[model samples]
Target: MTACLLPASTTLASVPIRFVEPGEDGSLEGLGDTECAYLEATGFKPTAGRIALLPDESGKLSRVLFGLGPSGATDRNGLLPGKLADLLPAGTYRFENDPDDGALAVLSFALGRYRFDAYKAGRADGQGKDGGDDVRLIVPDWIDAEDVERIAAGISLARDLINTPSNDMGPAELEAAARQLAERHGAAVAVTEGDDLLEAGFPMIHAVGRASHRAPRLIDITWGDPSALKLTLVGKGVCFDTGGLDIKPAAGMLMMKKDMGGAACVLGLASMVMAAKLPVRLRVLVPAVENAVGGNAFRPGDILRSRKGVTVEIGNTDAEGRLVLADALALADEEHPDLLIDMATLTGAARVALGPDLAAFFSRDEALAVEISRQSHAVQDPVWQLPLWQPYEKMLESKAADINNAGSGPFAGAITAGLFLARFVEKSTSWAHFDAYCWNRSSAPGRPEGGEAQAIRALYALIRNRYAA
Candidate 1:
């Protein structure tokens, strides 16, 4: 993890950071005549995310001006100050004005400071030499510094796991990460590994991962009070997806290491829930595997029995994410949790429909869908709801099995995948499925280009609101 939030200090030379709204240059009052004239001469018209450095009379760095766009305009990016973390020079800084949402500003600032330097040279301490930018923010009095740190920690955990390569992050390594998380939170963890999955009734999980040298395992972590509201989260942990017998092209296999992004995301969310001590009994299930091609690899046209007793015909071995998730979701559903949610970097169709910035989620429960949608906008996590559409259920029909792993046609690929997973989940459970790209195609203000954490924040907010302690 990178050193993001810094402690407040009284003696350090602090620069005042001011946010200016468009057409509101008057807000720069009390900055002294010389500084104001310098800003005006430089044509600093308060454009959104634009920054201007101001110097003092002695030619020393003084204050900084950041544009917040317009007053009535909605900032879908949430915190505007996050961009400043990378732009500001190595020094301590303080906010000049009190923003409407102080916590988000500080949280975003910490998020923007993140850098994945794990494999980079000179990172003996995990953070590289450039890590010592020494950029610090004096958090506003109204904002809880602890809360900001907690959220940033969760986000960093997900980013770190996703950014790691497949060589160092196989199924065994993923289980290790979960164990470390469980240890920190005083949670109990049980792992069902290798051939043991067969006896454990996770045949689909076993079949999907039988080819890999690294054994397949289901990571289950439980935390919080036993009597509290039951909240279960399932994540697809395909550590590397070679597409099994149906191998992907060289271009398509580049980002296969991030196939386990869903597991990383759920673990991150679980960390936040446990850290916040949310009044809920949280259960996290990750079906960790590597869909590699070998002699023992399951082939296309093979029939497999799921934990839910539903037989599935393999339409395509490449569509293995849902296979592993199906078993885990069935296990979670058996307990009939109050809320069951599964997230995966499942389909390219989802990316084509909603793009990389937005996540596509599906749910049969209308009220739960509305709440998640509302919270997504509130947190700026950006999720859109797609219907379960029972009519599309026929798309997954098979002559030999109860269902097919993929749809019969290219149309509605993401929807069909959602419907396939829905078969494992009990009808009475309030379940939601997130089909997220989990990778940013390009770098944005607070969001870096590599493995991004989507929907977790919004889902966390929803859980906190529903089970406020």
Candidate 2:
């Protein structure tokens, strides 16, 4: 989605988009008698999703009346104003009066205009000149224009990546995307691919992706001063998951293209950090792979040695995301980073527990957990903390190997998966794991129905505040 915002410096004779709550239209002083009568005659009430286009005596567009619903309306989405992007005819418009949340107002307006039009091709990569490009929003001085644009661009990149089909976004293509992002920020990246992963002690990563023609690889990205505090992010990049030997049913495989949502979202957050020039040493590790079934595919019941020297018994080949994340998390933990965070679409149980909007997170540090919750609510980027339930750790015990890749029971599936990854994260100062569902089930306000970047906004806010110079 292009940032559909005019530069804050724009001084053009633009039309004002006035906001009105229920029964507040009479207080609007700018409207003349004819316009007031027109509003009453038309029965235009400021209810949610309603917009009024007011024309002047010359019959030209002059103003807009946007609805805000009741003051404490339960379902009043903060991004509700985003509807204006599509509702209004192509023209330059400005919010005459600042809304209660100006930041969210502007951000939603830009994102509301998002469209995954790369393959369809009105705007390549959802950027450049759009058919709706003329629908420009005037950026007010109270909101940071550059910050909002950076965020919108980052999120749009993630959506574009996740929306792409696996045929065009396999392991190698994912690496190319990572490299492109690194190049843009002048960051350095290294990749260990194919059998080299076995030599590099990333056996689990190698085993999961060995069957695919697009050889699996680990992509590492680093930026900022070496002496600065280290923040490491590890993402499970299973570009397409067919569930390997225990292949998913036809219905289950429908949206497997977004199995690498963790990678896309981490890169989105990384983009924001680089663009804003945040003060910290950043490292992103993505185990890019495709979990496919073939003659060479790793089978259930196979025991694999991981980078951390822990052995895992594969009880289910479908549980492949955590296998790749294990090796990368172990490598990340080796540096004992100030903060270590790993994101993955590791379990459906997470989605069942928190639904699609709230990201389910597990953290070892109490303070970090509290701060993340606080930041999440403050920014309206919701996340709910799920405990690192110690008792559930026993469910992953393996008589064949040191641990089992899949838990013995279905109960506490999300918690047990976090337990599996936790075995390799012994050295990091603080660690958190997020199980996110990166696709939206339906369109609403600023959030569209396709691939969505979850929890990164809240994570960015926490990182920015915690590591500020």
Candidate 3:
């Protein structure tokens, strides 16, 4: 399915078209004579997120009509058209006119081409084949096609990574994925593996990932000149979290494979930045691991030393995401980069507060928080600002160690987790933490269920707005 911002004079070129609406006979004002009669014959009603096809006298589809929920309620219903991309006959179609938000049209249309066909047999219809539809967007002469393509590809990459199951994707797989990205962007790459993690001063990362048969490693990819503004991204790379010694129920472990969603998101964001060739020294740090139970598993109550030289008392073995992230975040902080951002699926408290669709972001810098909120909302990659809440710092204090890996109480779980990470950053560097659910529990018009890149688009937008100039 292709997307285009066109003028009203532009014709449908005989492609099947549908007018979307909220009810029957709603907003018939825009219908042409041929469109009206076709709608009647198809029994088309304007149902939100519903599509009705209009066929011609020769039985060929003429056009598609979609219904808007309500006239002016800030409803972002454009993505609904994406459903038609795979379901309808393959052909070029154009938006009658430019939408108020063109990005939605551009992103959703491109995303509609997504298909999780790794091991599955080919569809008899052959709709989504190699590389999906060769879609084209008809943008205004003023719009930059390169910009649109960069963003669309970034979103598609994230969706593809998220859709792949854990069995097929793990720490080793994530490194391979990162290596591919670095090769494409002409970036430098380095990795510290298994026992090497301890020798390299990433003990926390090693401790958490030691149980898995797949050895854990720290992935580093750098691009651009040393003198350029420095930006570092640390993503939680838990390939699968089985809750270690504090074993979770079978149901809780079902989606543990997607624990690496954070890594996938940053890779997606990095693709956009590098594809756009943003002028900055970019560094991506991911400590890839699988929190599995074994004879040598790090158990609760064990004290571990972090890269930052602080002692971390394990309050809960299940709280392993932050441990791997702590070492990676500490490494990023050592550079004192202009900006540091870490993304993770660290706590269930955040999901209780904002649900799965919105990521909770924490930052000491008010300006950065505001800008992140603005850009994310603008692009529909929703994120909400949560407080660092200095008072929560006390929850992490420990008697034996400098801090507890988990908070003292259940309240403010997300904030406390953020606080635990903050301890590693001695310098008050401009850092933002994204507590995001990288998985979408259910499918939507443009967003499919499975692994997802939450807050990635907004973060990329914010970075471009700030540094890309």
Clashes per candidate, residues 3 or more apart or on different chains: 0, 0, 21
For candidate 2, lDDT tens digit of each residue in 330-375?
9999899999999888899998999998899998898999999999
lDDT of 1 by residue, 146-216 (tens): 77777888888888889888998999999999999999999999999999999999999999999999999
TM-score of 2: 0.97
Model 1 alpha-carbon miss at residue 282, Å: 0.9
lDDT of 2 at 194: 96
Local distance difference test, each candidate: 0.87, 0.88, 0.78
In model 3, state the lDDT of residue 107.
61
Q: Kindly list the per-residue Cα lDDT of model 3 for residues 1-469, writing each as its tens digit.
A: 2232233345446352434446444456655667678768778666565566665566666666655456555654656655555555666565554544555665665666555566567544312222354443344444455676677666666656656667767789889889988999999999999999999999999999999899999999999888999989888989889999999999998888778878878888888899999999999999999999999999899999999999999999999999999999988988899999999888999999999989999998888998998987687778999998998899998999999998898899999998888888767468999998888677676666566778988888899988976
lDDT of 2: 0.88
Cα lDDT for residue 135, candidate 2: 84
